[model samples]
Target: MPILSRAALVEHLVRTRIAGDVATPRDNNLSHYRKLANGDRHYWLGLELGDRWTDEQDVLAVMAERCGVIDDPAHRTGQDTIDPELTVDGLERMAARLRKAAAGQERVLFATGHPGALIDVHSRVAAALRAQGCDIVRIPGGLVADEGYVVQFADVAVFERGASLWHTHSPEPMNAILDGLGEDGRPDLVIADHGWAGVLAQPVQDRVHGLRGVG
Candidate 1:
């Protein structure tokens, strides 16, 4: 399949949002949209990379459609519930891809701009990497605000679970995370969330082995 232009992809996302057929924010957090909504139960879309994009758009538009509420009282339906799709198996596949791509490096660091207390998933990831001969590290002591930049300087650096910050058009945290790594002498690979990869394309190229997870 030919790669679609970024502009075309963005347009696709916009159309999907206007159609009210996109996934909700909570579902996006879970990383898959609903494949089918049957009354109260939602069948989740599998989280294949192909499922992540409609042309070039990441799952952002779907989130806006599902979560962004309008204040008009006329549109309010008290009984309505937003049901979105999600699958634990699919998220595991994504984590596995990250683990596989980051394999064989001297050190693998998972850095996130969010509070460290919220990232228990990293511990499981670290154990998995150890079993597979990879040295996985987390930014120490749960003090995430200041130490993320340092973590990204390792042989392989990754940002986990950054979707909202991406779609809302925020770049400062992402920049601080990358710039702190010293662009002059950067790491071998910079694995990031899709939003960071979109804006920091060149820095990634000049500093590391290019961005991972733009999909």
Candidate 2:
């Protein structure tokens, strides 16, 4: 069965504050875009944006197209809305990719930066892929990254700091895994969310961003 009918998925997303009722503020998003436009590598999340975008408005344009946010530069300090249909589309696309990987028994590496909200979701997907005979690639434990260690639990890699799985927007933990895998033993596909996903996975560009109340 489908994860949810499209209508049902949209309802659940709004109910759960995943798309509507989002938590980001307008200033934060504009600031991030400004920093990204100014060539701050941290916000690029591992993508080599280079000097291609020198204006924050231009950056906002790309983000607006990709994320379904309103594209008005004049609307300065409230929450921006996320397009629920776009959110549904993104999730369905992820489902399709998982189906393909399972069919091919592809070697897939799973990782998450938002552990508290998503670890169980990633772990459950990892488990299902393994059941389908796909290779769920494992990263060696305690690998060095971002003043912490890269750790694995329930078949998903996470950034470990102070002996706990920590929230992160850095892509270093994923980078560490790729380095360790080497060219010969690399995974055929990578499943990730947030910065790690943005840096190492093909679907990163489809990710959506939103603001809290500026609509």
Candidate 3:
């Protein structure tokens, strides 16, 4: 289903509950402001039966975004702490963001930990997302540590790496990547699969409308 239509449904529901009428904003552009005020309609908590798929994180992130909720940590401030490892699932989610950024013609910025472990998953996901219209680029760091911290610093950094490089990979590089872009993508949307404290920050929380988990 389309995000706009889904957002429309959410808006209608919100207005009907409060005023017995659907406000249906003229803009037709559903944003975080509408979602945050109306109540989160997109996020849900629970793990899958097991780590069964290669790109489960990607699948879930997309589902969560479509549903209008951020995944994992319900709050926008970001995860309290990120994992020390990037599971195959984690890599997949980063790939999905890369794909989304690419499809929208946005310059994708990707980072991950245990590059060797995530490469296969990343490759598969990158290939799939690229096929769909996303341009992919692999940041130099293979398995980045302190991903949550670095991501918070970057204009748009995908968190797939673990916490090993956080201290070493200063926020400067992240800022540089964003600065190099020179221009933000139209209709910019930032999505994250992991990063507790990073995503919980004020602006990120404000911008993201929902989170949905997919099998």
Candidate 4:
């Protein structure tokens, strides 16, 4: 596939329902937000929430600010929206990070929870970075329990040019990878989404870049 310009990418996001009238329903978002506010371990995805996030409204507010989701507490059902502008802004920011990594020949790791939708994008970026001499790190391991189901490490495949990830919402995979890092070892950059992104960002905020509100 051809690389899309910023404007073209924004249009693609909208047309694909990755942003603007997003496929994630408002009710589902509220349910997740409620779980987060209530301190549900499974939903927290390795984030350490402060006491101020005790209320669901507070979570909603934060989501709205970061993701451009509707802020209204009254929104109970139907399609939730992700502002295309916010999606574009996030993509641009990610692109800038990738550019820096390429320039520095940074060691980078890529993972995702929305593999069905986003693998192509990540693979292309990984290939580009490889062309620039960046080492794309491959995490090796086996299946691990997440919530209830087992997620295989092979499901998240690392190749010569890029990697392919399967769907996963739990942070366990990322935590395992971080735990196994060598002393004085850390990827210079991590590209990921959903819980994978959140977990990686917790310990090393500067080296991780991700899109918020993607399911």
Q: Estimate each model's TM-score.
A: 0.37, 0.86, 0.29, 0.78
lDDT, candidate 3, 21-105, per-residue tens: 2233322222333332333322111111133323434543543455333355334342222121222235457556665566676
Mark the 10 consecutive residues where model 4 has the least summed lDDT. 153-162
Q: Candidate 4 has which clashing residue pairs, if any?
A: none
Residue 15, candidate 1: alpha-carbon lDDT? 61
The local lDDT score (0 to 100) that residue 204 gets in candidate 2 is: 35
Residue-wise lDDT of candidate 2 within 77-168, one digit each (tens)? 88876778888888888888888888999888888888888889989998999999999888865589999999888888989888799988
Best by lDDT: 2
Candidate 2 or 1, higher lDDT? 2
Each model's Cα RMSD: 14.4, 6.9, 17.6, 6.0
In terms of TM-score, the best-performing candidate is 2
lDDT of 4 by residue, 98-215 (tens): 7888898988777767667777777877888899999887664443434332232322322111233446666766665655554344577777777776765554443342322221
Q: What's model 4's overall lDDT?
A: 0.69
